[model samples]
Structure formats: C-alpha cells, structure tokens
Target: MRADADLDLLGVLVTRRGRLMEVATVLRRYGFASIAAQLDSAGGPGHRLVQRVTDRFIDPELASASAGERLRGALTELGTTAIKLGQLLSLRPDIVGPNVASALAELRAGVPADPPGHAEDTVRAELGADVTELFREFDPTPLASGSVAQVHRAVLHDGTPVVVKILHEGVRRRVLDDLQLLSALAVWSEAVSPIAHQLRFAAVAADFDRSMRGAVDLREELANLQRFGAMFAEDPGVRIPVAYPERSSAGVLTMEEMTGHVVDDGESVRAAGWAPDELATRTASIYLTMVFRHGIYHTDPHPGNFLLNPGVITILDFGDVARISSSKREQLEDLIAAVGGGEPRSVTDALLAITDAPPGIREDEVVDDVEAQITDHLTGGVDAIDLAAVTRGVAVVVHRHGLSLPAEIALVLRVVTLLQGLAADIGADIDLRSITRPFALDLARRRLDPKVRLGRAVRTGRAWERLAETLPGELSALLDHIRREGGADLRLRDPDGIADHLVDGLLTAALVLSAGELVSRSVPPKLGSLSVPGLAVAGAAWLRYRSIRARRAGAPSAAARLRLAERVIRSARRPGTS
Candidate 1:
C-alpha cells in the first residue's frame, strides 16, 4: 500500500504537528504527490527529511484519475468540513474551473440517521418532552440526514404534519475544530502568497466560518425560517414553510412539512400539472423578486430545493441565504445591463464597480478580456447569450486582474447559474432576455419612483460625503506606509493639487446629487413643472465631471494597479524596514 518515498535526509519543522500529520496522511492516501513540496509551509532541504516525506510520489491508483477526482476523493475522506468546502467550491466554477467544479458537485454530506434511538434521546433532551407526548406520531427513521442534523417526519397532537430536525451529537465541536484549522490555514496562505491575498482567501474563510457555525446551530435555521416566512406571508405564489417555535429549541426545530413534487423530477412536475414553461418563468420571476424587491434570497437554487405544484412553488431550506444592500443591488443591475448590452468596456466598468479591484486596476486589460468573452459567447446576441459563459468570463476577468467579488455577489451569480441549469433539466423553453426584461423594467420603475429617487439621492450624497471625508485619511495612511517602508524614496507631485481635485470632485458630486434632489422634488424654473434648475444643475455637473476627467488623463489601468499592488507587497517584504 506504500509507494517508495524520496529521502532528503534533512529536518523540516512544523507546528500543529498532529493535525498536519493527519492531513498529510489523508493527502498521501488520496495520491496527492509532491505534498511536501507543494504545501510545505517552510520549504528547504529539510522539508521532506524533517517531515519524513517524499519529494515526489504519486498514488498508482490516482495516476489515471482526473485532478478533480483526486481532490473530491481527498475531501470526501475528510468528512463534514471538507464536504462543505467541496460544496462551496462547486458553486464557484469561476475559481476552480467548470470541469473540476462539476466533478465536485457530487459531494454529499449525508450521514447515517442518528444511530437509531440516539436522535430521539437528543430531541427529548433539547425540547423537554418525550416524542410520544409532543407529536401524535413521531417517525423513528429520519427522512433525511445531513452532517449537521437529522430530519424526521412527525405529526402534531392537532394532526398537523411537521418535520422535526434534531442536531447530531457533538457536530458543533467537530465543525469548530475544522473551521479553526481552515481559518488558520487561510491566514497563513494569505500571509505567504500574493495570489492567495488577491483571491481574499482570508475573507472567504471568515465568511465560510460564519456560515458553517450557523449551520450546526438549529436556532439559526429557526430564525431564518421565521424571517423568510414573514417575508412571504402575503405572497400566495411563493410559500415559506411555517415554523413551530413552541416545539423548537436551540438543538431542535419543528416546521410544517410542505408537500409538493421536487422540480428536479421532471415527470412528477408534469404530472403535478405544473407547465414547465410557466413554472420556469415563474421561478425566474420569484428569484428576481427576491433580488430586486425583497433584497434577500435563499442562496441555494438547486431544482431539488424547489418543490412545485400547479400554481405555487415551495422554497425549502433556509439554512443558508444571502442579502444585498440597495447599493449592491444597483451595482448588480448595472453589471447585468453591461453584460447584455455587448459592450466590453461597459461590462468591464460594471464588473470593476461591483468587485474589489486594487487601487489602480487596468481597465484596458479587463475590457480586452470582456471583449473576447463577448465575441466568444455573447455574440449570439442578448436573447441568446449563454449566461454560464458570461459567468465564467467574469471569473476570468476577476482572476486575471487579481480582484475579488463580494461573497453575496458571487452567491447571486451562482444562483443565476443554477437557475439557468434548472431550465435545461426541466425541459423548459427559456429566453433569458425576455424573462429578465420584465423584472428589469419593473426594477427601473421602482427605482425611479419619486420617493425612491429622493431616498437614493439622499443616500448617494451621504455616501459621497463619507468618501470625501475618508479620502484624505486613506491617502495619508498610504503615504505613511510608503514612507515607513522606504518605498521608492517617496516623492510627491503637486500634493496640494490633490486637495483641489478632491474639492472639485466633491462639488461636482454634490451638484449631481442636488440635481437629483431637484428632480425628485420637481423644483421651480419648470419645463412645465420639470424643474429647469435641476436640469441646468445636472448639465453643469456633467460638464464639470467631464472636465475633471479630461484633465486627469493619466489614471492607472487595471493591469497597472495589479502590478502596483504586487510591487507594494514586494517592497514591504524587506526585513524590518518598517
């Protein structure tokens, strides 16, 4: 069972010794060769010798396996945390690429039902009641078992059907240990590697840590159910399962068992009298409504998560969801528009606006990537654009620029990708543009409503004000860092000129906000009642902004920003310089 190990005959040191040994064992078991060289934190002649590892060794079993297969196998062997990590990676085709991600999609975290009566014992302990007294009939067998909890169907004393979710014994402790390991690894990765820093591994790890912690706690799911139920209380088209708080506790939750056929079962969907076309359009609308109107949504859009009947769609599982702020939603709208319009520069601009690009990102390079993406996949035109390709295109650009997206935005994109996949699975004739157009129009109307416009204008001004206030402090920090690091003998060109530019930018920004305020209020000097002063102010602001932009013709591009960030990192690497 062992492959011949390469001997280095030197010593390499490592902390987390026991955990690292376990990890190395798993990695080696799964045929991951060059383990010491690839993942060795401190690489030296002693890396293998200190670790008693090989410089190169491949598992004969995995030599013919795809990279993804090897990864999936390794992760599966690692259990809960790794399975969840694989599931998350499956959603990110942009990071791992389509093939690898697709291969990872098969990871299932289902555990054997709570070892017979152990689940019942835990339920009684958590809810302070015996199963027989609480429910008219409690099923001993779990309907579904996950790494976190087990769900069993039960009926209340009132004969109402419900599902009782009981947390697995000590799952929290195991999950916590894994999350700690993951978070530490993320920090270490970011500290040592610029690529990991650009990818924001630390941020992703933190977010995943939060999500996983929430997952193991039944109360969080209870809260999510209550929040979603409140949101959809009046909407007949979309049904959120009702929660039974009286019967719930921190480790257990009881909820209405919604009855409908899963959408992934196509024949059942048809037999249930749901027209695929109508259902498809309705599903998209519901999701869009969640995004544009509700500002929050169930993160998972798998067809299996949706239960459909003739006139309604039931959304299951509130264990995970995402929320977007108004500003983020608007940025998403802009990105969608730019994607559909077939303008690479606009797409690039919108993408940059939506993501966390470095200070001096190269727009030209982003535009070129976007242009090629448009040529490759979007040239089928708006109505026929392959959204999956667009998603990949976006990932490509972001990765190419060493940029990172907000996790919510990435989840939204994942939802869209999943939704599109659902269309094909259910045999629905879908025109992506036509389906989105109505929602887009409604969003515009909602945005342009007088009250909404006014609110937006007010928020916009406050945001701009904050930016203006913070800019000098941020600039000072940057300069201080440069000086402290002795980076390029720090020099300034017309430092006070920055003050003038800031003032001009703030003034113009205010003028624009004022114009919106005027438009919203329909102030005096009317074209009929159209606020002539507002129009005039808007024009002036536009002109001023154009002039400022024209004068500053040397803005750094996306590529330049990336390079600059790298240089900054490199310069900061000097020993005790700062």
Candidate 2:
C-alpha cells in the first residue's frame, strides 16, 4: 500500500505540466544553454513554457566559462539525473576531457536532498515497514543524498548501528526517461556530425545505460558490499560496511554504519591529533590492495566515501564497483608495464586488445603524448607531482588518442586520483609516482609470474592438441575430394596453368597453417600502453602495407588477386577492421 502511494506520487510528479518547465529553469540557471536548446528542440513549441523559463534564468556569461566549468554548472542546475551523468563523466575523463572531468569530480557530493517526507516515505515503501519497526531508531533526515539514493543513520533491530539506504523517489523512471532522451540525442548527433564515424555515440549511450541501471539496483549494491567486505575481512586497517542480508531489497539496503572523519578533511584530523599524511598513505594503500591485489575495487572512491579513524579508513558506498577477472587483471599489468617502459607500440597494441578505440588515430603520436606527460611529472619537482595532475595528463592522452576507457579502468583512475587528493590534504611529502610505482611494479611482476605463464601455456597446449587431433582427418578428407573430383589421367598440359595450380595449393596450405597457429595461440592477457584508437590505426596501416606489397611483389595475377580478395573478405568479417 505504501509502495503504491509512493509510486503514485512519482507518477504525478513526472506527468505534471509544470515539471518540465521547472527542470528547464533549473538547467538555464545552472548555465546549460546547449542542453536546454537540445531539450527544446526535441520537445517543440509545446515546450515553450520551458524555453521561456530558461530564457529568464540563464546567464549568457556562465556559458562562456571554461568548457569544463560550464558543464559542471549545467549538470548542477539540471538536478540529479544530470549530476549522475556528471559523476559518470568524472570517472571517464577520457571521454568528457580532463577539464570537465575534474570539475565534475568536485561536484560529486553536492547533489541536493529531497524533502524529508519524500525520503521517509521512500524508505517506508522500500523496506515494507515503518521506520520504527525496522530499526531501533531511524533518523528521518538523510545524512547524504546522492544521485541514486539518500542514506540515513539508523540501528538495526539486532543493535547494529547501520545506514539505511533508500532509492530516491522516481529515480528509476527519471533515469529511464533521461536515458531515452540521451539516446535520441546521440542518434541525432551521429546523423548530423561528420565526426560520427569517429565518436561511437551510440555505444557510449549504451554503456551509460548499463552503468546507471547497475548503480540504481540496491540488491547489486548489497552484493558488492558483501563481496568487498570479504576481500578485506582479514585487514585490520580497513573496514567495509557489512550488509544486513535479511533486510536489503531491490530499493532498500541496510548496512553497518561506519563512522570516521573524512580523510580529505585535514583540519578535523589535526584536531584529533592524528597524522593526516599517514592516514592518506594508508588509505591509498588500501585501495591499491583492492585494485591490484584482489582484482576488485570500489569504483566510486571520491573523498566522500572515505572516512578516517585512528588506525583505519572505512570505505562506504559499494554501488559503484568493478570486479576484474584474472585475464583483464593481467592485461592491466601489461598496460602499466608498457606505460612504465614508454613503449608506445606495445601500449597501442595492448590498448586495442582491451578497448574499442576510434578509427584513424595514430599510435605513435598518442604514445609520445602520454609518455611526454608522465615524463614531465617524473622529472619535474617532486612536490609538484600528485595524483590529480597525473590523472589530468592521462585524461589528456586519452582525449588525444580519441579513446574512452572502459568502466573498470575509469574507476581505477578515479580511486587513484582521489588518493592523490587525500595525500595532498595530509601534507604527504611524497610524489604519487613514488607510491604508485612500487605497487604497480609488484602487480606487473605477478602478472608475468610462472603461474600466469603456466596458465597461458596450458591453454595454448590444449588448443594445439585439439588441432593436432583434427588436422590429419581434415587433410585426408581434402585429399579424398581431390581424388574423387579428378581421376589420375586428367592432367593439365599448359606449364603456366600447372604452376599456377601448384602455387595456389601451396598457398592454401600455408594460409591454413598460419590461421591454425593464430587460433592455437591464446589471446594476449595484458593491455599494452597504446590507446585503443592508436592500435586500430596501426592495424589499418599494416593491412594497407600488406596490400601494396603484395601488388608490387610481381606474383601471378589469379593467385595474388585471390589472396588479396581473401584478406579483404576476412577483414570485413571482423568488426572495426578498416
């Protein structure tokens, strides 16, 4: 009954005639003329009410600010959905650009809280009980309200002090509607932009959909919390909130509440007589352990989620997390090695294996740019090298290469960046590179360890054994076909024809062997240092060179053309092959 009422209120709010106009006014006030224009353009004259509101509140001056700041303000004005997008953007500096990503990072904790009654009603509906019945005591007001949910302090019936999380009223519907609108905009942009071939806007929208839906699911959030808690169970310095398995539902989550001052707050740490720098370093080590050692990480490690106590840092919010498998973990280690070694070609190849990069991007140029940025920080003043600058540099490299990071990589970058900020707050006299290097090196070594190598060898051996068993049968069948097709008496008299036939047969055998070898070799496990886009260009370059070389080598016409035709056909079969 309570759920029905809550949903009814949401329905009314979404359907009300004045609601869209309210949203537009907020957007304009926040300096989002471009987005407002897109909305108006999509909605037509009926949306004039929104347009008029936008016209009244908008400041043309704000739009003229740096592209990044403008976007941050715009999302702020557009409310939760846009802010959620900004949060996603914060993780994806590669896609939104560094300037924008940095600004969005600053906006993560600023989302406005819904009215107290609305939040209370939401909690009641989601928990399927009144607050009093579910908790020893429940705070009516939210401790924090984020894009997806509001969290309140409470105690479970079992006397465990926990946080009760309730999804924001109508968040699901609003997200879906916003996603539909964003998808439409992407489609329109692709149709009109000359750069559409390079952008892959549709893919980005699809990714956004997947990320947001996962974030909004409370059950998934609970599972992540439990999973992370287990990973850190033996670590005395880190505390992950324990979820109440019996209480959590799709829209409600109950988890042990962790209390500590935020590590980013230096003044508070100073007041407590604690060493802030030590706390920062310890915090960074914790996240590094989660990412590089365990292969699972808290995706959203913005300072807000990190709380510092005397000997521990408690991580809150498991809604945004990434669990990388062994294969991807190995690839990431390789990517780090490629970055450290400054091998652009290897980086490019590794990046291509890991991500979907844009076409026509130059591998060497991207690698040079990334290397230059990291080298500058390394050789520059030690005091000057922090996580933020390195991250911004990485974002720049990602942008120049026209490659967006996968969600997992983006999350890792976010955690690293936040650690840098935490270190700076605590007066760490260390360079981020100094701390990151050891951990990264250790991970890389493990990635290349005998166990990893043995695993790769075993996989390859299995494939080879299968091929060995199958090949003789296949060859015998082919020989039988040739025999049945032509009795031994049938022979070609022309020398050129006979030579052509012999060469063609040999070439066929060689092609089969080459293909079989490729299949037998397991895919490389590590991402290389190059951006995905760079590798794609390198691949295209290789194909074009092969085609030109084959034509110039003075090979016979039919066989040469046939090989060329075969290459083209094969390339076409693979998506993203130029």
Candidate 3:
C-alpha cells in the first residue's frame, strides 16, 4: 500500500536535483557506488546522470573498512537524520545482523551546542514570551546539547528547578529534507534492487521517518515523561522527573530537574550507601515491571540515562520508548516459559508466533536451531546466561531462516541488550531467567484460567462472525475479477497430464461441497440404501485414492510437471531451437 505522506515526500525529493546529486556523491564517496548506481538508474532529473558521471572519486581509506564501519562513517558524516537512522538500525539485529548492529551502536548523536542565544530564542519563540517572563532565572549556558535539542538549567517563579529543552533552530527542516531523500531512495531501491526488495527498504524508511519526526517534537517527549512518572508514582525507590506540560510545546519542553550521581559511577553509588548488587537488582525490577507488567517501557536505559540519587534511581530521557501489545506480551511470556521448559517444539512455536516467517519454511530446521540456542544458554545454569546474547542469537537464527520481526519487538530486544550493558557497567551478576520467570509463569497461568479461556472463546467467536460477514463480498469480488479476465490470467503452467490432475482436484472439491450441503438437510435421498451424501463422500474418497495411487505409480505430480515445463522452456530457448 502507498502512503500519501510517502508519495508527497517522494515528489519533494524528485524536484530537488541538487540534493539528489549531493546524496549520490556522498554514497559514492563512502564506497557505496552500487547503491548510487541503482539510484541513478531508477532515475530522477538529468543531474543524477551528471552526478554519476562526475562522481568518480572514492575514499581509499574506506576500502579496508568493513561494510558496517563504512556505513557508520557515512551516516555520521551525513548529520542528524542519517545518524538517527544508524541509531535506529542499531536496534534491529534481525535486519542488519549482530555485527553490523554492534558497529552502528557506537554512533553517538553528540553535537556541539547551538549558539547560547539560539537556545533562548527557540524557547522565546515556542513559549510566546521572553526568557525573563517564563522563568525567575534562565541560565544562558546550556547544560547539554545534541543534534536534535539542547537543555538549559532554569528556575520557575515558585523556586521549582526545571530544565528547558529546546529544539535546535532549522533542525526540523534539515532532518525532514534528509528523510525525504531517504524515502525516495528507498522507494527506488525497492523497485530496482533484489536485496532492497527483500529487506523492505521502503517500509523501513517510512518507520524511521515516523520515529524521527515524533522524536523531534518535544511534546511527545513531555507526554512520555508524564506517563512514566504516573506509572512509578507510588514507588519510593524510583524517580521519574515530573514534566510541566503547561510550559511545554511542540518545540519546547520543561521538566523538573533531577540531580544525582550517574548510575554507572560505582564509587559515587557506594558513597551514597547503595550496594552495586542491590541497586542493579532494583533497577532490573523497575524495568521488568515496566515491560512485562505495564507493557510500556523506556527503550534506552544506557548508563548515561540513569542516576543514583541517594536511595532513588532517577531515570532520564523519555524521548524514546516502546509499547508491547497484549498479544505480543503473551508471545514474549510464552517464549520465556518455553526456554525455561527446555522443549524444542514449544520454543520453536513461540518463536514462530513472534516473527513473520515466510510460508513453507522448514519447521524442523527452526526447531533444531532454537534447541541449539537454548541448550547453549542453559549450560551456564541461568546466572551465566546472557539475555542479550541469547536474544541476538535467536535473531540471527530467525534471519537465517528468512524471518523478520516486527519493529516493536526488535526494539524490545534492543532494550534487553541495553539492559545487559547496564548490568556489566554496574558490575552486577544477574540471573535473567530468574528475573523474568515469574512474569512468564503468571501469564501462562492466566491463560489456563477459566475466565481468560471464556474471554478468548468469545473473542474467537466474534472474529469468526466478522469474517463470515465479509468473506462473501471478498470472494465475490475475486470471482468477478477472475471471470472478467478469463482463464488466461490464471498464469498456470501444465506439463504432461498435470491439467487432468487439476480437473480431478476441482471435481473432488465440488463433490465434497455437494455432500456437505446434502448432509446438512433434514431429509436426504438414498443411493443403494445409503444416504446420497454418504455415497458422494465415498466417491470423493475413491477419487482421492486413485489420484494418490497414480502419483505413486509415476504419473507426474504438479511439482514434476513444473520441472518438466522448465526443462522444455530451456530447450526451446537454446541456440538453433524454436
């Protein structure tokens, strides 16, 4: 399906030849000539061809670099949008593989602060007041700055301390322009490149666009802050900074200031009377509750985003978060249970349920892979098991089997990986299985509850009812199109006696349907002292038996027919053949 926003963005890119050439030059410089060639071949204005011809220079230093390193370097050079894209790709091991994701994970969005005056100007423009009017004290110097926004320390009129986050001037336009270029390139790549098509580049670009756009808006961050704050309001050990929405806008955010030693500072934490082991366990518990219980969790929990303020763990940066649907939550729960149960089939089933694997993939192969991963992790007796490694291993297996995970799930896995890093930073030994086991078991038990079963049944019944209501119209439309296009549009290839087999299958289906109708009636005719429907079913059984027997007797099956057809086509296309 084509999204209107994507189409609009594509149009915008097409009209900007200068920008397209710049993109092409950058791609070529990064040793991505093939991608640039594909983009040029896909066509834009004449400048694309011109750029292709003139852009002959390649960086020799990048020649020895791995693809991931080259890509990371290119993105870092491209500024905010590309850096953000790299950061987003870092979360998707299923798409880019663990090695590439690890490389991209090193990308940091740290940029020099915008001019001190620019920050105040943004706040004044967004809040519709001078900096003096909005706060009793507004420090001109910035506390921190990044590609997207910068923060300033300020005090409210009532002596409440807060930090003001202001979006950089002209960032939205530049980022959007880059996103548009990316969207256009992805659309073109998907159309012309097999690898791009397989990866679904356009969809990935669309998702990235949505994510970057949302993150760019300070209002979304404010909302995330408020929601997380409410979720942990009763927990004395956790601290979520309070957001002042009244003073926040799409381009400006004001939140209560949180001051503490950074969580990764073990010496400071110890000085504050908090043991590393206990602190790590509490941190894990807080995140686990957010994920498995609340179903909404912060996606980035790096050491820099956490703080140790006496007894409280202060969480910062709600700019990025993820949510899990109820069904997906259940799938995750089942996955944890399956791993703990040490059953290959159950693990495989849970993995398949959570991913979008292509049809006809070998179930036994996936099962074997899952078994191997589970066994490898289990050998260490829970505490030694690295959740991040296991998760990355599963993703590798899934990718090997031509499966893809939904973006939300991929982000969740990324969160798990980050948690492992956080654990390492705090020098804490954790049993991931022990931490997650109760939530999984609780979800399993809930599934077995009578109330839950009844609710599932009702949901299933309603779903079936809706399908029944719509199926006829959909089938009718399909049949009408088939009839209108005639049989040539079927695009079937039959060899030898395969067409006869097709006829036989259709006849068998007709007989089965007729038999069903006849059996449903209150009264039915008799054939040789048996019900007519019974005779019809017996006839279908005989026909099926005959068909199977013929196949066993070397009569060409559909697959064999296809092979024969291919051989004939190849022969016909050979030299001096018609």
Candidate 4:
C-alpha cells in the first residue's frame, strides 16, 4: 500500500488480482530503468544507502524506452497529474508530435479500490458519521475509480438517488508535490531552451496546477456542474448533471448520476433511435452557443463525457471549464469575420493578439500562411464547408507558427474537433463552419454596432486633439509677416535659404494651430449628415487656406494636401467613419 514501495513487491501482490505483473510490466515499460540509473548516478556522492534501495527496483530495459513508451510510463508511474498532462498533450498534437502524444493519450489512470473496509472508514471519517446513519443505502462496491477520486452509489434519506465522489486518501499532498516538481521542471525548461518561447512551458505548468487543484476539490467540481446545469436549463437537447447540494462537501460531492447510451458509439445511438446527424447538429449548436455567445465552454470533450438520448447530448464531468473574457470573445468574432471575408492577415493578427502564444514568430508570415489555409477551407466545398475543418485548419496554422494555444482557444478547438468526430460517428456530412456561419455573423453585427463606431470616433478625436494642442504658434505669426512683406519673392528664394526655413516653420505652426482650434471648438451636435459635411467643409477650408498661401508665395501647388482633403471628405461621407 506504500506509494514508494518496490514495483516488484506491488507486482507480487497484484498477481493475486491477476494483473499485478501486467501492471508492473506497463510501469517498467517506460523510463524506469533510466530513472533508476539517474538515481544511481546521484547516489555515489552522498546516498549509497538510497542507491541500494532504488537499485532493487530497477528493470534492465526500462532505461532505453522509446519516447512514446517513456511518456506512457510517466503516466503510469505518476498517476493523476501525469494523466491530466497526457490528456492535455492529446489536444496539442502539433507541439507534442502525433505518435508520442497519441500513445500517452491512451494511458488511463483507473486505479484499484482500497479494501471495502478502508473505503468505509475513509468515508465515515470524511463525513464524521457512520455509513448507515448517513445514507439509506450505501454500496460496498465502488461505481468507478478515477485518478483523483472513486465514486459510490447511494441513496439519501428522502430517497434521492445520488453518486458520492470521494477524494482519494492523501490525494491532496501527493498532487501538490507532483505539481511542484512539474512547476520546477517547467521553469528550468524555459530557462534553457528555444522551445520554451513557443511552448510557454511555465504557463502550462501553472494552468495544470490550477486544474489539479480544482480536480482534487469536490466543491469546485460541484459548483462547475451547477453552473453548467443552469446554463443549459432552458435547452432540452443539452443535459448537464445536477448537483445534490445538500449532501456535497469539500471532499465528497453527491450529484445526480447521468444515464444514457454511449454517444461515443454509433451502435448505441442507433439502438436508441437517435438520428446521428441530428445529434451531431444539436451537440455542435450547444457548444457553439457556449463558446461564441456565452464565452464559457467545457475544456474536455472526449467520448467519456458524452451520452446520447433520443434527441439529447448529455455532458458529464466538470473539472475543466474554459471561460473567455469579452475581449477574447470579440477577437474570436474578428477571426471568424476575417476568415469569411478571406482576409488571412487579419485572422493571424487577431490570433496572436487574443491568444497568449509564445513570442518570436514573424507576425506577417504567420498571418499570410493562416490566411491561405483558411481560404482553402472556405473555397473547397460543394455548397458549404464544415466548421470542424475550419477549426482544425486554424489550429494547425497557429500551431505551425510556433504559437502556443492558450487554454481558451484550446478548449474552443477541442469542442469543434470533438464535434467533428461526433459528426463522423453519426454519419453527418455537416460542415461545422456552415452551421456556425450565421452565429458568427450575428456576433459580428452585435460587436460592430453603430454605437461602437461612435465610441471609436470620439476616442480618435480626443487623440487628435492631444496632438494638435502640442504644436507651437509663434512661428505662424512670423510666416504671416513674411507673406505680407513679399509673397512671390519668398518662393523665389532657394528652398534651403532663410526664407524657406521660415516658411516651413510657418506651415507647421499654422497646421498645429488649426488642428487645435478645430478640436477645441467641438460642438455637441447629434451625429447626423449636417455635422459630417460641416466637418468636411472645415477640413476643406483648412486645406484651401494652406493652398492659397502656398500659391501666393509661388510655392509648389498644394496637390498632395488637396488630394488628402478629398480623401477625408470621402471618408466623412461614410456613415461609420464620420
């Protein structure tokens, strides 16, 4: 039962359970030998006694484990923390490489039960009451044993059916220790490698710490379940588990046990008489709404969390939820708009700006490449393209640009990709983007409202005012004096001569003074046609004043300034620009 005991000893005891040797073999299959050797190498300096203890457990072939095998072994050896990391790596195939990440993703952290008596003792200790006094009926057998907790089915006094999630004994201490080690390693990696710039290893480790903390606490999980339930309360097709708040505790959570055929398999769905295409559409819609509209989404969308009813897609497990801010939501809207508009550069910029990606990437090239990929997806279709493909394509481009996908984008990508997998499972030929295009448009129009435009214009005017107020005016008076003296004679002088210098100073002063006056005399008029044309005329008058002064001095005609004035007039005519 000791965590640090020799694997061989555990193997011997597990042999009685028929898979002890197999489990030991799996654990030993990854870097166990090399790890032992590393320990041995360290032992020579100050820990000969410790080396002997570790040497006893070393297997010959473990040191030479393949990267995939080593990763799998780490999952087996470390338990919950490693399993969570492996699961995270599964969503980031581009960074981790497909083979190793796929192999690690297959690692499950299902554990053996503590003795029934021990489980009973732990549960009673947690609740400060005996099992019989606490519940009408308590199952001696565990319903499930995950890395962090084990579940037991029970009934409350009022006959409410619930599943009790009990935190494993000493799980907190163990998880904390492993997380600290991982955090240290993440920091060290960042200090020594270029990959750190792109991988953002430290941030990933910190997020993992937060995720593990949430996982170990039944209270947080309970709250998450409640939030999700409330979010889907009005939507019949999307079902979330209901928390039994009366019985929930920090270490133990009681919730309504969800039940349905496995949506992961097509056979179960077909048997349930649920149309696959409809189920896929419904699932996609629920997530799209959560991410694009509500800005909250489930981080994990693997098959284990999904169940299919006749017309419903039930979601379970609430340990990992991603919440995006309003700004991030807007950026996502911008990304969708850019893709729809076939502007790759905008999508790339928005991606870098919104997501906390690793730095040192060429923003321009990344944008162009992402644009090309998006264009291909948009154009390659019969009548419409799939959203799944679009999402995957975007993920791929961002990954290739050495940009790390923050948890928010990762979750968004995960949901869309999972939906794609579901579609394939249900025989749906739906294009994800096609179904979500209208949703994307609605988001855009809401964000790009007339009010938003007016706010932006007001902000720009304030900035222009600051620039104008910073200019000097004494020089303009001197230039005016010169103009009165001899307008044509001033232009005849060489440009580098004293007259030219004075003219340059005069023009600068005049422009600054004019801009300052325009900003200072701002009127509180309603944003209407009259106000816009008035601004245009003021702009024209300023330009005309400069032109007339220049012409009188026999200076070059103010052609460039005139052209700029015309452009401003055109812009002012636009409803939003004004």
Cα lDDT of model 3 by residue, 1-578, tens digit: 33654565568776776767776677678766533333223335554665565445658777677767877888888788889999998987667766778889999988788875897778778888988998999998889988898899999999999999988888988888778788877887677555456567788899899888987898899989989989988989889999998889999999999988876556766866788777766777788899888999998888888878678899999988878888887777777777766678988898889877766889999888887865467666667777777887777787677677778678887887888777777677665666667766777688899998999999997785565344434433443453465423232544355554654554444444343333333334664477655765776677668667865785634433233323332332233321
* lDDT of candidate model 2 versus the reference: 0.65
Worst 10-residue lDDT window, candidate 2: 487-496
Task: Highest TM-score: give the candidate number.
Answer: 3
Clashing pairs in 3: none
For each candidate in turn, the TM-score is 0.74, 0.69, 0.77, 0.69
**Overall lDDT per candidate, in order of appearance:** 0.71, 0.65, 0.73, 0.65
Q: lDDT (0-100) at residue 473 of candidate 2?
A: 47
Candidate 3 regions with alpha-carbon error over 4 angstroms: 1-10, 33-56, 449-451, 463-578
Put down candidate 1 lDDT per residue, 211-287, tens digits, no spaces: 89888887888898998888888888888889998899878899999998877656777987887777776787788
Per-residue alpha-carbon lDDT of model 2 for 1-578, expressed as tens digits?
33553454455556553645665566566545444343222335645565566556657677456656767776776666677777877777666667667777777545567776885676667767777877888888888877788888898777889888888878888777676666555555555543433446666677777768887788998988888888889888788888987777888888888878865466877654467766665666777788778888777655667776777768887887777776776667666665555455666666656666766777778667766765456444444555576666767777667676666666776777776666666676444455677786786587589998898899998887686446534644554454465523223433234534443453344344334433344433222554333443454455445545644674434434344434533432343332
Model 2's TM-score against the true structure: 0.69
Candidate 1 runs further than 4 Å off: 1-20, 31-57, 358-362, 450-578
Candidate No. with top lDDT: 3
Clash count in backbone of candidate 2? 7
Clashing pairs in 4: 34-63, 386-431, 386-432, 386-433, 387-431, 387-432, 387-433
Error of 1 at 356 (Å): 2.9
Clashes of each: 8, 7, 0, 7
